[model samples]
Target: MRRKILLLDTGREWGGGTNSMLELLKRIDRQKFAVTCCFYNNYSRGNSETIESILNSIGIPVIFIPQRRQPMWAKLSKELLRTLFFFNRSLKKEMIARVDEIWRVLPNAKAISSIMRAGQYNALYMNNQPSTNVEGYCAVNNLDVALIQHCRIEPQLNAALVKRVNERVDAVIAVSHGVNQSLRQSGVDAQRCFTVSNAIDIHQTLPDRAEVRERLGYAPETFIFGSIGSLITRKANHHIFQALGQFKRAHPEAKWKMVVVGSGPEQEKLAQLAGTEMIESHIVFTGFQNNPLDYLAAFDVFILASRSEGLPRVVLEAMLVKTAVIGSNVVGTAELINHNETGLIFEYGDIDRLSGYLMTLWQDATLRQRLIEAAELRVREQYAIENYVSGVEMILEKCIERRTHV
Candidate 1:
């Protein structure tokens, strides 16, 4: 019999994690396992429901848990309770806060859990980051079912939470070695964890560079630098403009333009910094592209300056499109790029070094082509979707085998 798996997600929007999960849901061997996905009906933004829709279309039923549709009173009450918990040092108040959370979440968790039990799900898989979301309580409380979690971020090194997740979940899958290292550093058992890199679906046909440049109002000769990510502080978008500013000042005669894609709360701050750096004219901000991959061909070099990441899907996409990628030497980014080989990596906070690398890649066409060729080869061999899904399947099968035997 095909084992039934209950998958849960608490994300409010689409991202690398959600996109990767969508790929897995679509490709996992249905003959070996059946999947039912449950997602919170939270304030999901553009294309956030892409996964839910795809899952439904593939004969996989998606159920939205109505836990996010809280009443105004309940919302206010929780805020007040959290505020009270923050200020009160008393043990009684902490206990009260715990009681309050349990009171609010238990009934809903019970409802979700009841559905899982009725369905006879062999395992509960969590994508709604276990440490922050309350969606797992119901499933975790059911001792008969296997609980598995995919930890995709370098969570703040919380020993207790790490220990709890390790103890409860039958398996914990990390998206990269960086995340796995993080879990182990936090005292999670290495034996219980696995590392799986996110895979990307490469678009077979790309628009000609000349055509793309013309439509976007760029000259064919103009050197294009592209950075696609949320314009948030953690993304360190300001660093892109900062590094470009220095790079531009040194290469005054070079005809170049940078396209900044994606939007967030830090838009105005980034705009101000662009102006302050006097590189505003050379920068183009395309906010919140639903299909950022469509614009990848226009970039000679792609940049990822995030303060952190979990095997970013964009870097892979950029490489597949044959664009030279330069990434900040942070967790997942560092793991993706081999300095001066597949791609270039610079110290996270060092704008000057980034500028230097950017200039070197930008000036040397032969080197850029070499890096792009190398990156595309490496990504296809190592980060393809089939390998990723197979890895997931192996882990699920192992977990099921262990649970049934015990």
Candidate 2:
């Protein structure tokens, strides 16, 4: 008989981790594992229930765990508090505030317990940010079910909460080796952890870039550099603009333009930065794009300048598109890009080196083409969706085995 698995996302929203979960849910072998997603807050932004819609299309049923919908007043109150707290300690600090989290969590705990009692699940998979969020609260009482915490970020703080949750979770599935190492250092059992990189749907990604670019108002000759992700401070988009400024200055004759995809609080700052300098004219902020692959196709180079990462899915997407990449040399990024091989890598905070790499790639068509070809080969061979799903299945099987044995 197939083992039953339940995936949980509290206050459901499809961020990067949840996005990866959606892909996993769609591809897991139904015959070997009965997977049911239990997400609360049907009205949440990014709609965790959309996973259900996608699942139902494939004849899979998802179980929804309902909670007392917070009234607009309470939500506003919490938002007002969070805003004030953020002004004081920042989002990361507020997240690790376990004492302040108690009052907000009772409802979530009740909801998760209700779902666990409703189903006979062999394993419960908690997507990223699980340790200090709703999952951490729900995990308070349950000690029997196998738990998998899909960690996607390196929490610089929260050592105590992470340690507490790590002690209880059955496994920690780090999205990258760097994340796994970080977890181990935080006292998660090294033997009980695994690294499973974020992946792209190989089939969905096989589109013709030339046609897509032409449709997006870019000629075939336009040398476009693109970056995807929310315009958040951690994403360090300003650094990219700084690097681009220098690249344009050095290679004045190069027909290069940049496309900044996605929207966030930093959009205006980026726009203002771009406007003050003549280089801003060469920079186009495409705002928020749902289908960024189209923009990726129009690009000769893709860059990620995050202060940190958990093997960003965009990096894989770019590689799949045969787009040469330049990534910040931090944590999980090094595992994905081999400097001067698959793609270029620069020291995390070095803008001059970044600009140099950008100019060199833009100037040398042979080198750029070589990296693109190599990246495409790597994606097809090692980073396919099939491989990712299979690895996850194996992890689930082992968890089930351990659960049954215990």
* Best candidate according to lDDT: 1
Per-residue alpha-carbon lDDT of candidate 2 for residues 227-304, written as tens digits (9 for 90 to 100): 988888998988888888887777788786789987788999998887755587788887666677777777889999
lDDT of 1 by residue, 244-334 (tens): 9999899988899899888788999988999999998998988877767667878999999888888888999898888899998888888
Q: Backbone collision count in every prediction?
A: 0, 0
Q: lDDT per prediction?
A: 0.80, 0.76
- The residue-level lDDT of candidate 2 at 256 comes to 68
The Cα error of candidate 2 at residue 270, in Å, is 1.2
Candidate 1, after superposition: displacement of residue 224 in Å?
1.1
Per-prediction RMSD in angstroms?
A: 3.3, 3.9
